[model samples]
Target chain A: MAISEPIVLPHATDEVRLARTWAQPRGFWGWFMNVHHTAIGVRFMVTSFIFFLLGGVLAAMIRLQLSRPENHAIGPDLYNQIFTIHGSTMIFLFAVPMMFQGFGVYVVPLICGTRNIAFPRLNAFSYYIYVVGGLLLWVGLFLKTGADAGWFAYTPLSGPQFTPGKRSDFWAQMITFTEVSALGVAICLATTILRQRAPGMTLNRMPIILWEKLVLSFMVIFAMPAVMVVSSMLLMDRTINTQFFNPANGGDVLLYQHLFWFFGHPEVYIIFLPGAAIVSTLVPVFARRHIFGHLAIVTSVVATGFLGFGVWVHHMFATGIPQMSASFFTAATLMIVLPTAVQFYCWIATIWNGRLQMKLPMLWVFGFFFVFLIGGLSGVMLASVPVDWQVHDTFFVVAHFHYVLIGGALFPMFAGLYYWVPKITGRMMNDLLGKVHFWLFFIGFNMTFFTMHFLGLRGMPRRVYTYPPEMHWGGLNMLASVGALFMAAGLIVFIVNFFQSKARGTLAGPNPWAAGSLEWATSSPPPDYNFTELFTVNGREPLWDNAPNQPIVSGVRDDIPEVLITNSLDSEPQHKDEMPGASIWPFLTSITVSIAFIWSIFSPWGIAYGAIPVVITLIGWLWPRGHSPAPRQPALEGRWSK
Target chain B: MAELEHTVRKGEAPALIWWCMFGGPFAWACDLGFSYVLEQHTCSTGHHYVLHVITVVCAIIALTGLAAGMAAYKRVPEEANDHGVRPMDRTHFQILFGMVFSIAFTIVIIAEAVPRWILHPCQ
Candidate 1:
């Protein structure tokens, strides 16, 4: 089929007008109303990092208390709250937000070659709720009333009879806020990936990162409901005198575990898959080759998400369920390794076959390999019923997951940051500082977590603040504390690198890495509308194949907030969809919802009255504002500078 | 805003994709629930045969759901979710997706059911 001739350019005046129309307005109100996905994505990143550092501080305190036998940096009572908030902060605030919600919202539209996300207002709404959720948890901690029921908040002990306080209530509601945020982004991403591909770019042609993201969106959708249900049940039991986990009232304690781990197990993949997607994305770029087994990798990722649901029972192995049921969980848990192994091998194969470039990103990939392998192998041992029985609540399990999460999520996250920092910040990060950060981090991480398996094997359990001198665990505890300090040093190095590079780093033009995806097609940091003109994607590596004169897609109106939607399988141009512009309604709506949730802690009837304001705000957000012409450049464009 | 009137939903994905994505979890949940209920029933009133029958029935039901998912996969277009620009690409990506899940679910459902076959209920 013959391609249509390119649409004629509308000249400099139109471009300036388009830029002004899409530009976020100035002042504090504009900050609240900004719905641009890139800006929102950056907010998610910056806010989540603050939480990560705060969580790290809590961790350092835990390390201090546990440094030696009979150490008294803090008491067991205080220890419980610190550790609970530490886990809660990292998982809810840092991991999901930084990995899936932040990075996905930022990159998904750019990769799909669209101007905005599917639900821009909802995207912004999720961010505000996330911020409030973080504030609520931390504010309670500052007042010396943080949650102490462990991150999972197991029942009966956490019930009103055993422990009565607002701590558990705060924890439960925080889950409400964050998971609602996650679920909102999940719908946005899934719809965007499914319906928003550029013309001529179909499923086969999409980068592997998008595939992992698509799978993650589905996992978030299906897995999050289990957690939402369990958390609500916990809240209800405590506040409303319900009997969801009250054993004396015919409620089963095990019911909570079943539901929590049902979501808990898949949550691993939810966070980890995006990291793997990052690896798949950068490996081929640095290796100077197309990724090997693209379809197989996608299949493996989808398989991981599917099989993730089947294996939740494995986490409950120590409860002494029926032997037959235990065996089934054992099988599913062990079987999950095959797909992951396939992915690892595919990465290695791609590197082995291509011209390897030993860049900073590649250095982290190597780090990911070494660290994740240790985590994965330890996990395999725990998958066994007998072994898990021996080490179920020990530091061994703790060591295994730390390796998994840090190696799986954090390492690749840095790699993505370094690789794309230029594109996002318009400047290359300091290469020497990046290398220093990586080596320091890798050594410190292993030193901290690796010794833990032995401590656990030596009979040191987790969640205990101090130990008897006769236990002989003090030396290793001291070593782990030293390791934590080293990792903190590495983080400080990264922090210095981030800000310094942003302000004074080398300038990076578009496509700094000479990579293939569509994101690299625009200017450094991109324009307000992202693309001056969209390109037709006819192959997987459009940059490599059609660099000089990639076909320009036109007919999209410049004056309004509009994006192209395409057919799912073939990316056939279907229609233009209008995006919601800047609004304070999403922000107002989130406040209304947060009020309902927090008020429900005091009274369940809060939902009844809360419905009114929330409904009104949502209508305000969605009501059609008739299209107005794009704002013209001020008659005196330079007058704003004065 | 008028442009949204022209927006279209993608064609329906093959049924197998839905089954594979959701069927296995549903089957596992059913296996867990029914077996737990059966245990409480039998432990209360000792009818060993009824326990055995319940175990077999749940396994059969789980396995049948998976088999039906496989049967659905057989009829799906070869390119269900693929990015191919041909008629054959109708749902290539979706089909491959369902196919992968179908195999995984079969393994999981079978693995899940294996415990039912081997271990005695209420043990």
Candidate 2:
């Protein structure tokens, strides 16, 4: 195949025009109306981090109350709300948003060498929806109407019979809000990766992060529906006198468990796979080598996504599911571990084979390996029916998940933030403070979660407001509480480091780490138009392999926000796509949707009345204006086409 | 015109490649759903052999996927030294991924089947 000569643009003039075309709106209105992926991505990260802090605070409260047996600091009622809200906030509000939506929206386009995400307005809409959902949950908590039926909200206990009121309703509706937002973002990202890559970035040449995001997107698409369905059924049963989980009326309680865990188990992978992606991405850069076993890693990620769906029943072994069925699920659960082990093996091999750089970010990756490995081992134990039966509804299960979630999600998240913050803020974070923060967090995390295994073995049950003083669980509980304080101090250090770095840290150039991926090819804190000129890569590590002579895409209109559409598989240029400018419709539409969702908790007819405004706002959003007509498709024989 | 022509010349991937990629997972999903639904029937009817039959059928489907992957892999020459920008490189990656999926799913299917022989459905 013959390569066409690259298109040369008037760099100075085009940069100004591109900036003008893609610049977000200014001032207060601009904040809501901005549709750029970067702004929305940053919002997702910051908002989720706030939720993480809130969840952490709740965690501290729980620890304090539990530090001594028969403590009366928090009563049973409040304790139930605290623990449930803590679990919900971390998983629903923090983990998926920070790991998947935040990172994917922020970085995927830049790496793909495109100007913006595929559906920028929809991306903005998802963020607003998420904010409204977070607000609803917290507001419910303050008003003393918070969900207390566990995060999973298993029925009969959560049903209208045992626990009546709007408590469980709030939890179910929050699930709807976050999952809708997640599903919307998943569509945007999958399309962006499939259709918006710069020409020459075929599927084979994509970075491992993109592959992981793509897999993550599909997992969200497939796995979220089950949760949404089950949650909706719970809401209906509570509000509309529906008997979806009312066994007296022919609805089985185990059905709810089956549906929730169906989504619930994949929900774990949905959270962790992005963390693994962060590790996969950072390992190659820190090791100063091309990633070892790229194909193997990609296969493992895809396999993990598939196997994730099969292992959900492992969470249901003690529910008295058929022995044969339980055995199948147990087998499936153990099988899922192989892919993760393969990933860990590949990362170790990469670090061992290459010149390893023990940077701040890499330090967190090491933390992940240690913490998440323990979590994974415990998880394998829980996979067996006999072990799960022994420790069911105990602190051991709680400890296993905390190690997995915190280690698998939080550690890699810190690594990713540290690795990319320079690119995001155009300044470097303080290494000395970062080291202090890491040590405090690592020691605190292990101290807090590790003791729970013993507590479980010694017969401490989970979700209990208080234990008898004679149980002798006081000393270890106090240690865990102290560890919580240490973790809090570590977070405060990080918060200080983040703001300080933003204000006065060392200026970092674009390629601070001389990373191989395309995101490093542009300036730090990239311009409004991410790349002044689009690039077509010749290899996976585009900057490393084809730097200085990478082929530039041309014919994309500079006066308007136009992106190139490429073939899904081979990424050959096909046409130009004009993007919508900043608009307030997505924001307004989200408000309308939020009203509908919130109002429905009070009356089922809220959806009917809500649909009218939602339709009106949606019409306003999609109504086309003559000023920004779609770009004319270029000839197939043009420079970009060839 | 040249790019469109090239795309046309390259053509769609063989049906086998798609099957190789998704077939094993699809089979496993079917096996899981079927055996789960059949568990109650087996418990009531005392026909535990039906679960084993489902597993065997699913395993055979997974093996078919594995075979398809192997055939595809043999057809596409190794591009070990080539930059992965070419169509052949993409095909090679997909085939390898499909092969791995097939192999993994087969093992999972067999693993799921083992308990059927040992544990009574009612137990």
Candidate 3:
């Protein structure tokens, strides 16, 4: 085959074949060392889903134990472990990894019209570290010491004097592992979104999903640090008796709350924004039109990111703070709702005007609107200092967040799965089964969480394993427990539908849903290099435009996995960035980091000695490859300061 | 709306963006955080009035700096390319993103000072 010229290259199918030959890894060890965004993305989805199931099972156990008054279904000690693990696993392992890392990795490159994510090895390292982090938590659980001080891991309760042993250490270490993973990917994504977008896919013309992701990536950059600080502080206090949280040593408990909520509050947006992105991506496709308020939505997403940081204190309102301090948070929290409301209204406006095609994905969008709205309203109620005083630690708070997490994250997740699984697996999910899954899950979800609001309002405290029959709370608790069963049944239906559809569902070609995004402009489960010929996107929906096959972005060297680095605003091609080929270094580095984290749990000195392998592995990893041209200095100026 | 931009030195756009992203939030955090620190320090050290006046001045300065940055960010044009790197493409929206929060931060700082004005320091 002839090397085609940059301007008029065609024959995408031929290029696909050539790209595959160079891009695809071979067997066994090759798969482990693969750095392709798609491969790593699929792994993230799989791992997070497995963790989701594990977390769900723990949830079911909790509900089962609490179903009957004075039930001995599970002891309090084990129950504490279960609840803590469930929250930690779902938030850290399932929600953030699955939403931000998995979805962002898979779609951002394709949408940006790049061959692979920037820093591909770092991407792989993030995944491996996440896997290790998740596994360590579950392993600790099996040993019956899975961070029993709650997901927040609040002080004094989680302080050295009260909780001993490796339980809290595991929680802190697991957090370090996951956060390092999240932060690494945040950098990868920020670089990719900022630099690798195709020519003409300018800032304003870029899709809403990309904007949401850019903001979320930056959020991960800034927000994840606070948690790491708190977690490490807690670990130091426990292991070395630093007394960061101990009142006797001048460290304040509220300081922990301040730091934790600083990260914890944005953590909610970190998880929720991706779900909103999925909805933004799908709403136009399902509604049969371009979105309403495209610019407004983009601004709002970024605005939400900015405002999200200020409202952390709202979560700490229950702690005794001055009225004036609480009011500041209250105002910040209230202000954030405007941007969110803009997003919801824009979606509603788009769908109302669009030629509505209520497919499986759209159904979940509707579900998201309903459930997240309730959660949002409850959140508003909680934002008020006085209302939060009553329901801060109650099941009402439980009801609110489930509405947020399940409705906000999971509902959109399933929608995105239905929307993208075909582009992933080349098969449409079963429509009938999808509907059954949605309805069952939706009904069961409402039944389970909504009842908790009443149970909480009726004076039932949270984190308790059992309640007395005389409390008259058995009825609501029982109802809530039964609702969990329905949700489980619904989930089972989904699992069957998902698996069955993968092998037997109807075939989906390049654009099954007639979506306008760039991802669908190629084969259903696009080839190893994603696009055969990258497009110079002229508008938000390039495929929706009248051009029959848009112009291609050439000049990327196919032999070496080259990608075009473009200007952020106009997406004008800057230069070619060579994507690193698959290597075992990232995997090795993950092990090095994991060993450091695990050892630090027992002795702080492990971090120092651990730095040896880490530094060695990092040297090997960052060492410039032998293939590239040496850096060209201006003229012959080898000496510093000519 | 027309996409507007201004020419920048080679690497200044990213710095501008970094400021645009964090300036407002940091301002608000400082106000909130300083208030927490000042509230404790003043109450303990018996200088509540001085602490209150000091926080108000610092917040005003931070607010002005954030405001000035937002103005510069808004002026970044879509066509502004430092060499071939066009970090200014989304500068307007990013400015708006940060500006809204800057306003919110102004509110937060003002809000943070409310207790310093109305309430007794520690007793």
> Model 1: which docking level applies?
acceptable
TM-score for candidate 3: 0.89
Q: How much DockQ does model 3 earn?
A: 0.23
List iRMS for all predictions: 3.5, 1.9, 7.1
Q: Per-residue lDDT of A491-592 in model 1, one digit per residue for the tens? A: 999999999999999999999888988889899898878777777775676677554554566656667776767766666665667778899998999999
Candidate 1 lDDT, B22-81, residue by residue in tens: 554465556555655566566567765664565455555445545654654455444444
Q: Which candidate has the top score in DockQ?
A: 2
Superposed Cα deviation of residue A407, candidate 1 (Å): 1.5
Regions more than 4 Å wrong, model 3: A1-17, A629-642, B1-31, B40-123
Query: Who is ahead in TM-score, 2 or 3?
Result: 2
Q: List the residue pairs that clash in candidate 3.
A: A569-B89, B4-B77, B4-B78, B5-B76, B5-B77, B5-B78, B6-B77
Best by lDDT: 2
The runs of at least 3 residues in candidate 1 whose Cα sits more than 4 Å from the true structure, single-residue gaps closed, are A1-14, A546-549, A626-642, B1-84, B87-101, B110-118
Report clash pairs, candidate 2.
Answer: A636-B1, A637-B1
The residue-by-residue lDDT of candidate 2 on A288-310, one tens digit each, is 99899888898899899898998
lDDT of each: 0.80, 0.89, 0.82
Error of 1 at A104 (Å): 0.5
Task: Output per-candidate TM-scores for chain A, rounded to 2 decimals.
Answer: 0.96, 0.98, 0.96
